[model samples]
Target: MLLSPTFSILLLQAASSLAIPGSVVKRADPVVQLDDTTVTGIANGTVNQFLGIPFAQPPVGSLRFQLPRPLPSYNESFPATAYGPVCPQQAFNLTIPSDLPAETQEVLEVMNSGSTRTISEDCLSLNVIAPANASVGSKHPVIVWIFGGGFEAGDPAATDGSVIVNKSIDLGVPVVYVSINYRTKVLITLAFGFLAGKEVQEAGIGNLGLQDQRLALKWIQRYIGQFGGDPSKVTIWGESAGAISVALQMVTNSGNAEGLFRAAFMQSGSPIPVGDIAHGQVYYDSLVNQTGCSNSSDTLKCLRGVPYDTLMDAVNNTPNIFSYQSLSLAWLPRVDGIFLTDDPQQLVLQGSVADVPFVTGDCNDEGTIFSFANLNVTTDDEFLTYIQMYYTPGASVDEVKQILDLYPQDPADGSPFNTSDQNALTPQSKRLAAFQGDAIFQGPRRSFLQQRAGKQETWSFCNKQSKALPYLGSYHGSDMESIWGDGAMSDYFLRFVTNLDPNGNTSINWPRYTLDSPNMLTLLDGSIPLQITQDDYRVEAMRGVSGLMLKYPL
Candidate 1:
């Protein structure tokens, strides 16, 4: 998704509405034959976009909580010129803290500015944008994108992939781009894509969003060649929740790539330290009771029968990304015995990780944006209690104390890292920002890379742009424009997708990250736009957080 320069909007609508009066005429729409179906796509200058093509059958009715089922066949013509309806979003009614900077408050509101598109249960669709001239024999490398909205909201329409497609053409490494729409929290299956508890566990239907993505990958493998893409050279990429999805996809199915993708590029996400689907039993029960399914023997079936609006109202009442609970989401991916056999961190430790070449990184202050929800946590006692109650309930007192010692209360030592003694807002605000940033974003990413360093080719980056933003620093999702808006990151991404390495033809040599060297491509905003640095900031703190996460999986 492309954020506007002022950060006033999280997703900039596509510029397809622009008009040039009589000077511009619509080009003939491009057509591709997929099996027996004739698919028509909009011809947008040098790129042709095939939008809203369903890869799986409509996941409505009895299919609400079940795993995605591939469409048996494509026997009809499709006008793939517009995006389909998005899965129902779990709305966020969080209030911005009055103590925060006005700018920070505006940004918080902007981040939660949800989409205006139609919402429906029949939203398992994928989109493709390829060179206008790409024929069946073109065989270009393909990059599939998974959007990030904290796993509660998002859709394919949030991003305009043609930017990357056009950039690839300009870079002389033309490639195809694809984005998918998967069910989010409001699916009628109690949690739609991420329903949990023993019922979902025994049924083996957890992580349905990831399942939807998997099905989309399978669809691409079977049909992308018709759109001039080489199925064997596919790269899966995403940001935030989408990035976490990429990491989980890498480790799931016992690390098997399943011939779906050969590479991955993740930003601001990693395999989180979450336990089994049963861990979400409380939330599942709450949904059941709220949706009037508590009396039913088969709650899953009862939920499926509930009216869509009623179920959505119950889902919306749960904790969202912006709620006081923050990143402790009510609905998210978990270790289902079938799709995800173990805790993601445990899976990594057991060496159940794909050997695909990949790139993963994060912004400098990933937690500041999320810290707004906890503005009331001022005193040190409140901070410690909050961590124990919400973040790591399983950690022993000594371990939580160790975490507190590592992440001190001094504002100078807090996030907006170098600003020192500034942007505090409240006594514990900066402290919480530092700890949360490392615990969730920085710590997990470092651990994932360190564990898989030598096993496969790897590269890492730290986006430090917008470092001066008050209270928020270079907040989460800040680096989006660099990749999606034709910045240098886009060039690096295209290079990585096409060659399995991000170095060729790039202005700077992005060295591979290794255990001993741990190089990170640091993105800056000044005269030195880029620099190579060791990924060694807060080593002890991050290591402590990683250990705590393993011991107390969220």
Candidate 2:
């Protein structure tokens, strides 16, 4: 008996569902029923597990590139055991050569690990891990985590919340932990073009990825009570791009302030300069041309009609690194008149940001991690030339030479005859590292502190301990080891997350950052911690550059 066409299609769908990992097994629990659809998770003696819970409707077919719409509540219980599909992303698993520097190899190895490689477009789901013993009325403080990938790649499923959950239990906090995934790549940026027109833009809103995050927060506010969490006491935390998103949420007033989050923990990323709609329009037009879509009255209709794979391929082909190799593509939150009213730096300067407690800092050697991207400089002449080419492009040749002299290269550094060996020591690397570090990380952090010091509680630190294979003095992302426990730095993070303080009555006294007397806690080598009375010379240098750059409008 041959099946009919409709029956054949249904059979194929059922077979596909069975082929995929349907859901995770649930531990026995009295609180929730142990059905095939629901799974139970136990961590630190607490049993709770939620999987495949939809915060928004699927962005497929007609909805592609449009703002996410809220998922309708299902009358029947839905399976939420396994994580939902990851949002589409380009693979970032570039192989490092065996003979590369140990620090470079180590950093690359960690980044290319299994946890980072498994990314997909269908990954717009979130997970929650709470104490098993938590009752409905527990009202524990909730921590909502947003992962970072330079606004390109990352998923909440990559991080395991067991450690944070256990530490929270140990500290008698019994908190709930939530992690979410947002849209990325072209899906994030191309949406920005719709901000110009009113009618069409309303239907196909820009910043759909951010809108996804806002919807997730709304879900937490509505459903967190079921998981024994206090929605009013939620703390938004993220690293890199995730941190920047958290900062945007705090500053924006687009219905995000309905008692959603009370505090914020921004790790590495902050609101720096992002491309405006005027600048972004060029990229949008380029994408439209690449796709060969019709420029009809319904531009979004034509864009949405394009094949997903075709659009994704275009995005992957787009060059992310700059031509001169000075900076990565600045695809971040823009001042879209909605989420962002003005530049974050300006907002911070004017004390316009919400007066929430902020804890921010950076790794000691951020630029060192990005050393491979630097244009190799062998001599003081070449070093100055490189700076002039990349940094002071608009200045006259003589003016560029003068600026180079102002920040001259060191005398004794050796030159690399060939480009491959340009990894050799040069004053260029040191100066670039200092300039990039200050301009990108340290200066912005200082500016944030200066503006928020007297008005809000702020804490800052400079992580210096390195677990680099050859020890590169705590380069970029070393602080993650402290939070995730891949290295010795985990204990401090455990203390910080669980107790809301990194220092737990230890010998080291972690002081709060203030405007008049700004002190930074230095995480040094060995067991002894160091405190710098005044700002470091590198910081001062960067501050000077930051001041100079501020003179010109961004």
lDDT per residue, candidate 1, 213-256, as tens digits?
89999999999999999999999998888899899899998899
Evaluate residue 207 in candidate 1 and report its C-alpha lDDT on the 0 to 100 scale.
91
RMSD of each: 2.1, 9.2
Q: Which candidate is the best by TM-score?
A: 1
Instruction: Give the TM-score of each candidate.
Output: 0.96, 0.80
Each model's lDDT comes to: 0.86, 0.58
Q: Give the RMSD in angstroms, all C-alphas superposed, for model 1.
A: 2.1
Off by over 4 Å in 1: 1-25, 98-102, 187-190
Q: Each model's number of backbone clashes?
A: 0, 17
lDDT, candidate 2, 398-472, per-residue tens: 654543544435421111101222343444765555455555566666777777777877777777765332323
Candidate 1 clashes: the total is: 0
